[model samples]
Target: MASSDTKDISYEDLKALLGKSENLFLVDVRSKEEVDKGQIQGSVHIPVDTVEAAFAMAPEQFKAKYGVTKPLLEAPELVFHCQMGKRGAAATTKACELGYVNARNYTGGYKEWSEKGGK
Candidate 1:
């Protein structure tokens, strides 16, 4: 069984963090087609298949490609989400393996965000 110790942030917690943290990076790992329909506002779309490569890029390159500052390895609010949860969790784990020890998964994901009236 997978560890229940994986770091996850809930919708309410994420909302609070969003209001307070200018450093937060909300990364959406869903497909482009799924993302074209709707997404949590302010999320950076980085498809799940490209997550590792994206994370490996230099800071300047990442910013050029994604149009946001590259989050440092220790960034406190580096959060990932998908249409649902699985991909986000996987991305979080991948980030942790890459030294992003503070990485987090928004396990509630975009579905819950939309359902909860997140904009």
Candidate 2:
């Protein structure tokens, strides 16, 4: 991870990003248990603990592990979220340190997403 002050994006910004780009990755860093309840439709699961490992894997291995194609070393934009902002923020920092310069945290996370009827 780079620093505690990694960038954060609002839910509105996230929605706009979703509309504007296909070169995006929405990573849900909550545990599998939490994700099993429900998740934003297109997001992928990569718990915080494994985020570093995910980026470290070989390209083929990474794809096999996370299912995205070209965002192995340098992602267009990788957005992370959990129940709230903290863990996602931490993971966002980690992603950036791992060379994903475009990584960002969904500050409101799933809680706000749910509150806003995003599901």
Candidate 3:
């Protein structure tokens, strides 16, 4: 499991990942209704309420449920975000517990991203 203080990824860093990191996994930890409003382009939706199930699913189940390839269990980095930041942080902790070495919460989450002029 992650330490008491979860690791964090900045919005700028997330942008850099989108532009340059092929191994990045961006997760949106928001509800379906909340996601209907807006979300980062290319981010996979995995609501906070069901994140454990999402990650624990079989590869086929993952692909069918999330409409993307199942992210490797040992992925280099798994970035999570929510409307604000807390949920993402909690999810990050969970991801680390699941053995992802670089699970990270995007501290400046959707609200900050939008405020910073991101679509």
Candidate whose TM-score is highest: 1
lDDT of each: 0.90, 0.84, 0.87
Q: Write the per-residue lDDT of candidate 3 for residues 1-119, one digit (tens) a residue.
A: 45767889898889888888888889999889988989998899999988888888888999998898877867876899999999999898887777677788999899898898876
Instruction: Name the TM-score of candidate 1.
Output: 0.94
Better of 1 and 2 by TM-score: 1
Top lDDT: which candidate number?
1
Cα-based lDDT at residue 66, candidate 2: 75
Ranking by lDDT: 1, 3, 2
Clashing pairs in 3: none
- Model 3 lDDT on a 0 to 1 scale: 0.87
Judged by lDDT relative to the true structure, which candidate is superior, 1 or 2? 1
Give candidate 3 misplaced runs (Cα > 4 Å): none
- The candidate 1 region of ten consecutive residues with least summed lDDT is 1-10
Error of 2 at 64 (Å): 1.2
Deviating ranges (above 4 Å) for candidate 1: 1-5
Query: Model 2: per-residue lDDT, tens digit, 35-115?
Result: 998898789899989988887788898777777663755666689999999999889988888777778899998889989
Give candidate 2 regions above 4 Å deviation.
1-4, 70-72
In model 2, state the lDDT of residue 113: 90
Per-candidate alpha-carbon RMSD to the true structure: 2.5, 1.7, 1.3
